[model samples]
Target: MTLAATIAPQLPYLRRYARALAGNQGGGDAYVVAMLEALVEDPRLFDGDCDSRIATYRAFSRVWNAMTTAYDAARDLEAPHHRLDKITPLPRQAFLLTAVEGFSPDQAAQVLECAPAAFSKLVETAGREIGAQVPADALIIEDEPLIAMDLEHLVAGLGHKVVGNPRTRSEAVDMAHALRPGLVLADMHLADGSSGLDAVNDILKSFDIPVVFITAHPELLLTGQRPEPTFLIAKPFDEDMVRAVISQALFFRTGEPAPAA
Candidate 1:
């Protein structure tokens, strides 16, 4: 396959990482576009040893680090600063690469040009930093008792109080209206044959809050056809992924200090 073809499928996923890391879609896509341009200028630099997807990310990391260093020189390329960036540089990247993108420690370390042990520390430190932040009230909208309970546990573990777990669209809307949660986790399908999307839309009208959709239909939602969730967790998620997205969503939504990259 041609280099572009090989990189094409991974581009969307890479863009997702960029959006998360940069803290906004536009800024992230700008960096992503620049990385693609850089890669086109010299495709040979794409590391052949690692997985192609990982190699592309490694290259993007280099570009991002460079752009960050010379941000003032390229003012148009600067990304929005958020509190999450304050946790330090490599950890957030490492955390997202592994937790959000499902890259192994070895691969994520390669992306950051760091050692595996160092990468592990980066992920751990970021977790602690995020966990230490002030918790907020949360809601869960899932038809399955198990999933709703699981989300409730996760939300509580993060020091947030769970306002309620609703099983249907009406329940979700009703709970959201009454409770006004700061965070919400919704499922794409509910028990009562109602769309989770509609439920979220109704709740959004009532109040603006950070929402994470844990769905089995990730491809349908992430196809770029609809407004994407700021933070998304696919079905069969790990705790680390949940933790990372939750931290990111809350961090980006609030008026907190996001350190210079």
Candidate 2:
């Protein structure tokens, strides 16, 4: 089946799952829309010999899992937060179908290729694991529109909120003053020639928000004395590293030990 043919019927379920995960109405809707587009481009994952409803649910689960992983990595690189292990073999299809997508346990078990009793246990365990992670509020500052949007998606996935996207150093500073965001993810380069360092200075002058600098120019490190608690992530990074960074930054700010350097 074509991607659209596979996913169009699942849109409502996907939206419900996204909203449940996001905890915010607007953000959940946006996230589902993005995931649907991604599904259309990669439909094979969702198209299979299984019954159509089961196949659709499996595909939706996969798309959400991929997006979460990608977004988590991006966020970690930008700001270090707590390090929780990856979700294990919880039968993604069963978990989604039984829990979030509202499939009956017997039906979900069939999709997961497992027994109904086992599927129920898996769903409960996975749900508990997800509920354990506490999402932090984040501030994202990037000049690029697409990158900013991706970052927003990632932040929301982590159960965090994106306070604002300030393209310029001055605007970032102003946002920091106004929002007092828990963490800041900033590109080293801003809208003007001014570097993120300018905004960093302003934030530090007024508050103690932690920062993770995203820069394409790693060589910029050679220019001057670097700040303590220095968190620097090179651009074009995979989402895993980003998640690690964000988890580390948040943990450190919360008086936890810094993630291993």
Candidate 3:
């Protein structure tokens, strides 16, 4: 297959990772653009030496670590956002790559171009430092009381306070605006047949914060839409996955520490 074809299917997710690394869509996409340019100049960057996904991330990491001044100029011109200022870069990257992005330790090590042993240390340090962050006040938006309760329990267990659990699109937006939660966990569909997407967008219009969407029909939202959420989960989601995404989202925003080891 052609290089573009090989990378195209994974591009959306790669963009997500880049956004997380850079702290915002604009800056994140800047790095992704640079990675693409580098790959275009030298197609060998995606050589079949590794799986296409791995090769793609490895190529992006090369661009990220290089941190060329031109890319900085581009991002500065785009408008700057403070991110990763408090967390150690390698540790945060390692943690996000492995924990939130679901890459195996070995795979993440390969992408980061670090020895497996060293990569382990990076992941460990990241977990400890991130877990050390102060807890955030979180908001839960779901139609199902059982699921909402479960989410509330999970949030509280993470040491974050649950500010509200709103079941409808209107309630979700209202609670979000009123309470001003540091993090939001929302279901895709609400009780009134309204969209969590709509609610989150409305809330975002009033304030900037991290959001996690839980959906039964993720394919509906995966259409390469702009303002896409970086954190998402499928119905009957894994608890570990939910916790990790929430932690990662909060980590970038509040510089919240990661959970205990």
Task: Please tell me which predicted candidate would have the highest TM-score against the true structure.
Answer: 1
Candidate 3 runs further than 4 Å off: 1-94, 99-101, 104-132, 254-261
Q: CA lDDT, every prediction? A: 0.75, 0.61, 0.75
Rank by lDDT, descending?
1, 3, 2
The residue-by-residue lDDT of candidate 3 on 1-261, one tens digit each, is 888899999889988988766766877888889889999999877757888888999998888888844234223322112334345778767877866578867888888989988886776565445545646777888889999998887677666888798988888877776777778898888899999999988988877788899888887778896656788888878654565566667664543322221
- For candidate 1, write residues 51-159 as lDDT tens digits: 8888889888988888865232223323324445555667778767866787866777888888867775676667556656646778888888987888777766666
Q: Which predicted model would earn the best lDDT?
A: 1
Per-candidate TM-scores read: 0.61, 0.47, 0.54
Expressed as tens digits, the lDDT of each residue in 108-219 for candidate 2 is 6665557756775665444334333544556788999988988777566555678799999889888777777777888878888778877788787876667887778766
Where is model 1 more than 4 Å wrong at Cα? 1-48, 52-90, 96-106, 109-125, 219-225, 254-261
- Predicted structure 1, TM vs. truth: 0.61
| Selected candidate, larger TM-score, 1 vs 3 | 1
